[model samples]
Target: MDRTAPPLEVATATPGIAWPGLPGPAGTSLLGLLFQLDRTQWWPAERIEAAQRRQLAALLDHARAEVPFWRARLPGFPPPEDAAAFEAAWAALPILTRAEIQAADASEALLADRLPQGHGEYREIFTSGSTGRPIRGVRSQLWELVWSAFTLRDHLWHRRDLAGSLAVIRESGAGKAPYPDGDTQAGWGFSSAAIFATGPLFSLNVTTPPALQMEWLRRRDPDYLLSHPSILARLAAEVGAHPLPRLKQVVAISEALAEPQRKAIEAAFRVPVVDVYSTREAGYLALQCPDHAGLHVQSEGLRLEVLRDDGTPCAAGEVGRVVVTPLHNLAMPLIRYEIGDLAEAGAPCPCGRGLPVLNRVMGRRQNMLRLADGGRRWPLLSSGDIEKLVAAAPALRQYRIVQTGFDALTVMLAVARPLTDAERAAVIAWARGKFGEGFAVAVETMDELPKSAAGKVEDFICEVPEG
Candidate 1:
């Protein structure tokens, strides 16, 4: 596929306007940023790092002067002016965690004493608490502008049709777009619609059953669909029966898109699946490359690091904990915040983009399995293995594995009916073979599996305490 960007075109709201392609003030600002990003994305790695250092210097200075929590931690007022000295000082800073952020938020220690002029009002935001620890922070209007720019950048990178209809199936609060009836808007919400005329956007809460969600999609027949990877997987099973003739692409968000889920969606829907790595607190962490499966970090807006257990940078193809610092967010600057996720670092992409690549996003730290020998590994269950298990137990609809001890696992099965004795033995045998031979595996049947508040269900969960 050609990695070149498409020609810039703006749609006019008024048909008879004298300036057909001219955009409004907001649109003009967005276009200005987008134009600059087009060149910055191709900058060399060294150049990108230099730019990030300059921005980080400014952010650190601001944090030390205005934020109380950072004042004590960031000693040596006014960071070093030399590049090498500054780099050393920056690395010496402690990695911030979710628990500390929550503590600081209670006392307003993380917030800036005063906002910069023209930054505009701030709004308080809370995370989904999927990690068992939700955090609160403030987002300035300036931060929102940067987020919107990145959102537009992702759309442009994929060369998506701006006028195509979009469907969103994610968490929805009360009075927002709910289930059954759902909701529809005249145009795609801000960032895209703020600049260009777009097709209507349809939304439905993800809590709706897969069968109903499929019926809703068949009714709307949208061009693009966006939802969590788990939701997409469940919906994939229904697509074989009720197809969406107009569906062009699927975007998986909120959760890591494993290889099995990706293959299932593409095979069932007969369309490409694009995965986006982002969070509620920090927006647009990494977006899938247009020409490759790897993801490119949004270095223009964030300073992301993949660090080893000893706090050193990971080499190419090394899996490490993800740490991020939103360079543009001044209201609540979370410098070097550990986001509780693991990802594999990659060498420079073949696509020629200077952005860093994440070879694969291995889910959260809690998702790894703990062995009796005090070792850890990501549980591997291939699609073929899953098919074999289903073949052995025809009543199995879905399954989730929960680690109860170092050598014990409980397989929760959502099935149509209780499995026969032979089928039960087969399920247990399969789990033991995949996990470990000496491990104890128990099978429990359930009418259906439970989903998170955000309507996401994980295939594995570790209940054992972390050492």
Candidate 2:
């Protein structure tokens, strides 16, 4: 064994083997499962689906037996033990909506009978609740262990230098920055941290000014930086004005990342933008393929579906609603749950990963633009367009576009200085070009852009009627 390598025994080690100065065997064993799954990325797609079906069968059986909500709903449901039979039964189960889950007694959804079997203590987690009321759910230690495993899987898959720094800018209650530990034994908080060395983790609140964020990052000079797409876009623009020499990788999460935004960040930092698909309720769902542009579904952790409006499966290249079924999550199973997101289905990846592919995650439907012709579209804004807009208006700090009616549009901005008449006219002209010539463009200055309840900034919003 390499002396300087991660100071832990391999997964193939004997059952009771333990590292001299690290965590115990149980943590290593659990982490080893994730490491094992990391290697299974290239397993044939059918093989992965089969394993997922087996997991689904167990989840269904548990739900029917112990979950009061599922039991009452599935009174005739002793789903078959076999994979195909269970799949059919699973398909027959009604789709679960966020509203329905919120309306139902949350405790009734839990597998109470199985709680005492050493699955680890259960804890309540509230969803980000970006749209309406947040849905509350329970998670077990077993679930978190699996979650940590998947986190390790992402690290291994990306081949990140375990010793590099990871800086993140996100939301917080206390509005404080968590300084990174400069010690060599510092870990990234994954289950594998005990075995492998990890770099320091630095975090800042997203509410920090872009100038301050750049100053802080340049001072720290970290290897990787993580933030939401909107903020990253602003940071990229900031970096364009002031460069950072040490930042190597960009990890985007929380909000939907558009291709233009990814390109902007990559070009700004001269590094790859690794986008992760995840939610607060469910753990990591998929990650950007290391060798490819699209995402590789974390088949080991989730069973994802791209379905049409009618709930039928969508074909490759078709855009549809994203429905996810967490293979684990025995505490509160979210089977066939519509996460209220949209994505484009992708064909099998040439990288030889049988994991399902998503060509693009288009974000929430609420972000679409309403055209004057009664059509809704998610406009693919290019980097050049953004550059032109900012060039025309140097005072522009942030902006939001909303389509209030068929032909009327509103532009809200938080500016460093007031816009000149020519700058405002140029902005309106640019908006007219992108949206349509027939629409009326109204520009208004604001003290700040209003964020959603979950602290997300949507670049575009449409209020058109949906048939």
Candidate 3:
């Protein structure tokens, strides 16, 4: 429960150990920037904007000069650019969509020259495709440095115990263990280990059942828990009956989290739920504000725009599409890339941090349920909704709801035993009350619900035709 820094003995226990990729010049630069951000995050809004404008001008110059795609697109553009010229040209550029990025020639998008010194290594990142299609991206070591700095910023902002055991549950590769063993020196290869000693790290596949996951967490007794929103909700439901006494905090990432889910986790575990908004392609987008429930954009590394359907910027409390430009990613510049996500813009935080705020992340549009009247709305199901069916049928282990047609609904259930007629009737009745009797709901027993090709588990999917 102590959020203070680890004891001196723990910090000095592994003095020479370093994280796998953070040991050379790049690592030193990353560590330096992390320390810089620790101070810059407290600066005034105008100062932060000035720093962003400087980075923007440099990135635009690099893109126009060396990137083949941008060179052809921006014919008359010359290198010696200032913030004013950069802003004017950037606003005039068309928005880039996922399909275009996916179909475009990679060689054209990649910078053949002008890469930062000692930043030759690049890695390809892919989207989870929870929405409709998956897109690929390229990022260099310099880009990774920025990502590491932002990650450390998150750790510092939360004041987490550096020596506390960390537990993660997500999709894993084949033959991976439920609790992978750790090395003594690296202590589970945490980023903090590169600078200071860290506690052990344990992980298991999210595909594991709730009962087994509870057993796993109970054994580890971790101080911090990290996993996707859906898995965390399922684990919270299990913990509601039996608590994990050592659990101090929960970190939810990669999926949209509803207020009800947050409340359920907090009530069950009695710990704060810190949500991180990020994408696989763009790295860290926004982090949970320390003083508020909303997210503060990582303005130092990325430029974000929340715009309405007409492409104009959204004002305070307005919900619009999220487009991002990662300023530090020079391997492939994603200028005004539409990330196919929606978020509500928020007023500036009262916490004195100049970072922009996002009131809520509503997730991908394809996931919304379609009404019989041809209207789509996000099905705001609470923990109570899941508990209603689980209580009615004690044999139910897990469940998923999918809307296959305007009037057709399929309820997939993973159960220890087949549901009795009375229990099935109770589930049908609960669905009727929640989704209206107009929907023809059917119960289908299965071993488990299907996960996306990218390994994310979607609890709800709407397959109805959309205009």
Candidate 4:
């Protein structure tokens, strides 16, 4: 064994052994089993809602009883005080933005109230802060198992091997650890099927660097190759230029997987591109199902909602900000926590699961598009108007649309093969369609595009806040 290879000890947790016919990590928890039941298949929505209300009421009671922040702000509004009254005032409850959560010291944003003592065996998860910043938070060990349960449902829908397929993750950085002395196995157990994980940078410059790394990956011939979409696009182009080992699946996680990136990876890897829709499962509130209609919110473990600017529920199909109240994360509870993404909630999913569905999820708040007019900001591109234009030019595989001013903008492109005049014209024609022909457009081709800590390439970014 390579001296650096961490010892592989089969875990005795709920999910159990990761090999074929063996259970995944979810096998360790009793609550996990309860969540796996397909209740919505026959139960009424009203019943689910009622039960959920009771659960929320109980959680809030615990919060008031334990959490310092809630105890201070919610002196009179304790849980069970008036479940209906609290439900009515849900919108008025303190809305926690990323800035607020990240700024919070003393760990108030994370604690669950029911436990008699402090958090035990909890792991912290980090967010890329792709717009520019990233932060970390804790997740209880038990609830992490629940997250695994939810993922199994999504993966099973697609008919992929969750147990023993070779898995790959082009990591962003050394993510937060699940436990002291925690090695790669903890994450590997939750995500990949059997082996190999890497950084997004590894995919790029694979030509000059990782001379041995590339060979190892080829040897693995991983069934699932997961990484940021940007790096995948670059690697896809490289594979087309030369060839790597064929793969059964290519996945993008921790960042939005644009359609262009997906198509590019599929063309190169000769496989369907699946997205995990998360950095870690413990922090995952929503992820895509095999049906590919939209992502299903893990309502059993999380209560996800999308609210418009006024804090009202976003109407069906209308883009709104993503917020979550985690159901089982008792270590540090996230209630009415405004995650940075913009998404729309659809009606209950057709997957026969009682879980509500997210019709569309835009990029994070920082990636909000700056309108070419008076500089209005959009959460994420509600439409693929930009992606469609960039992909039209095959030479325009890597790109970014950044807002410099209300009407002024810069279009950055990392074009290895320069575009033909005709191709550029078509790209511009598409751009003209988006911002009108009179808009200023600057397209620069570079050797590489900037990336976030999570290894995501921001497709659309606006620095201006003057709406």
Candidate 5:
């Protein structure tokens, strides 16, 4: 045994057994992959890009030969062997959009004509439909392996306790995970369970009211809580004065974690909030850096790009559209797929990790507010602003802002009771001040604001069509 190795690297020995306890075949394979990932994370940026381009070249070749959609779009010849030429050819390829993927799927042109042997059986995956257009994609066994490896990396990077209980609150179909008394399993699912002896897993449906969810969390008293950022913020508000002392960390997934939400969750739980940027179609994109505020791109499994409208890559601190290509998904190669989200590029991290950094994953373009002058900007509403509004309107439970026109805004409030005239005025005043005086703000009280099928609620949504 290497005593100097990382704690997670050490194998769990069987009781009463001497040195070298069994980790099983599956565990052994996962550990072996993790060992490689451990080293790859430290490889210089140039070395990492060289490796990605090599894999990408093969994927591009396969796409050209097997996938009908790519066959029409990609060059007739294989990807250029030269690194610079390959990059140029890659950049020249059109960005794949969700709508295009849907069209290809309808035409049966998105999937590979044949699978590479030993890649394992195909598994179907569907996006959450948060953008109103859900995409269906196929994943090979190889993709699953990479997903698991990245999942393990996330756990290791956050230094989570595998032996500690995990509570999850996320979208689940009817009868799958019910309210109040959700579901429980013997161990944490997937990567951790496949390799380590873990604690119990508890889950509650995201549709449950925030108050009930908080009550359930207190009862379960799990060491870790995982859910969407919107849910976390609501739960944080429900916390008020009562803190979940047992929670060691909160894992925000699915949606981008806004700065206000992060601060609220951290302040409420008195625990760190780690954001994991991922999609159902493309397993893991980036994981929060353990030592810093930025998120490190999982360059080992995928190629992530932040691009400007001009089709050029964004520099450090510049915001741009997020495009991704899962390097190993040979079954359905989504080369340069635009995931329909915005993000800020980050400078190199001081942590010495070679992986690229994303300063922040801004929400989708539709979430940006469109000004009367035909310009879009992220609506600025600080946590303090929300606190003031809630304080002014004690009956308010939740609120969502929607841009109806270039100069009009609608504020939908879910309240316990009809707000007083002054409370309504306060809400309207806040919206106008946050957005702009030129915009006309209207307030509508409702029993509850509607959440997406995936149990996500955007704080702001722009309905005005882009020019």
Candidate 6:
């Protein structure tokens, strides 16, 4: 494809209106950055389809040559190298099932063995065992560069003044420990040529005890704050909902941000609360646009596929698992990486970025609730939604809805204070209405709610279906 930069894109390519850091990334060079940006902006429709065909060929050829796991599965290569032929032979590639990924030998996935040699070698990361079995994978300095670009692009999308700002994701001082595993969603700001560009990434530990976490945020009155919604909600509840007028934007990531969570944090901080969908394994993926609508994928350097449980593509408006390919991760390129989440597909966005639009991202797979209607949906009947309906009511401190059986739900709750009859009725009404009246509701107020293995307050658990 002839990489051509249309005239309009020349200006739009650099999202920083004032061109913060005028020509960023010295390594990429001004010309090189522009060169790369223009190349990625949006491949012409026909060109993109063609490039996909080529990418498929490259992936198949590489897998056969370098990967034993795949070579043993694919019977033979195609002659014409067309999409139809590739599709017909896909099953031969052997499904890289989650079970296999969770237990695969890392040695089989790397390129030519022995680290792709370069700067400040670091230990390859193992998925902090978030889901019991630890997933081992490589992380490199080159990935750091790609991570920065994707993050900055998100900041630019927010129209934040980056020149004088800073991203608080890193430790303020050198030698400070990084957030363990996937907890690095704190303190991100645009780095343009302004006062906000202090570039002091710091850790605002969400899992820390509330007393200490309250003080941490009090001391680091960062203009731009980023964190998980659950942490932010807990903080707001702790601090008596104080105002931090300087906080222009607060971004929540890594977990579901319910309406109530957003309300509490926005009310407490007096800022626009934005949320992003990203992960440590794949870097930043998508972010909620300024319109507060669903997330828009950065289709430029990444390709995303929403697939059914059986590895087939999900039709539009259907929810399916998310698989992604990191186009820029040359060190250890991951094609069709199963990200372990579900999303609803929608039509092309009017945002006109060429990035695909995801109607809604269902929360973590395990968080989904099974319904009496012989169906299951997430964030659909979760405590996350119920929390919103009851957030403004100070009588409720905590709540949970566990599916005791196919047609039964137990609403275990904790009240910091006594609830009036109206409040009690409200809770019952919402529970039956939201969780389906077909299921019986039993409310049990307690002193505390049960915590998961990860020390998280699991408010909604479907005990009926064994996961």
Cα RMSD for candidates in order: 2.3, 4.0, 4.2, 7.4, 2.6, 7.0
lDDT of 2 by residue, 1-467 (tens): 22333333333334554544344565676657865785678789877777777777777777878777787776454344465666666667788888778876444554445653756887788887776558887878788888878777666667676677888787765545633322122555656554555677777766677767887788778888888898898888788655677776888999889888888888888888899999978888889887887998888888898998777888999988888888778888787888888899999998888999999898876667765566567766677877877887879888888888888888888898889999999899989988889889999987668776555787777766655
Per-candidate total of colliding backbone pairs: 0, 0, 0, 11, 0, 15
Q: Please, what is the TM-score per model?
A: 0.94, 0.87, 0.85, 0.76, 0.94, 0.73
Cα lDDT computed for each candidate against the true fold: 0.86, 0.76, 0.77, 0.59, 0.87, 0.58
lDDT of 4 at 57: 72
Where's the lowest-lDDT run of ten residues in candidate 2? 178-187
Candidate 3 on 350-412: residue-level lDDT in tens? Answer: 888989899989887666788877777676677788778888788886677889888888888
Residue 85 in model 6: shift from native, Å? 4.2
Candidate 2: where are CA atoms >4 Å away? 1-22, 75-86, 105-113, 178-186, 190-192, 240-242, 370-375, 391-394, 463-467
Candidate 1: count the clashes: 0
Worst-scoring 10-residue span by lDDT in model 6 = 2-11
lDDT score, candidate 6, position 71: 53
**Per-residue accuracy of model 1 over 1-467 as CA lDDT, tens digit each:** 34464444586655577455777767778889898899999999888888888888888888989899999998672344466787777778899999899999999999999888867778788888777777887988888888889888888888777678899999888657766779999877887766777788999987787889988888889999999998898889888755678888899999889898899999999889998999878888999998887999999999899999999999999999999999888899999999989999999999898999999898887878987677779885788888878887899877889999998999999898999999999999988878888779999998879887667788888888876
A best-first ranking of the candidates according to their lDDT comes to 5, 1, 3, 2, 4, 6
Scored against the true structure, residue 214 in model 6 reaches a CA lDDT of: 61
Q: Which order, best to worst by TM-score?
A: 1, 5, 2, 3, 4, 6
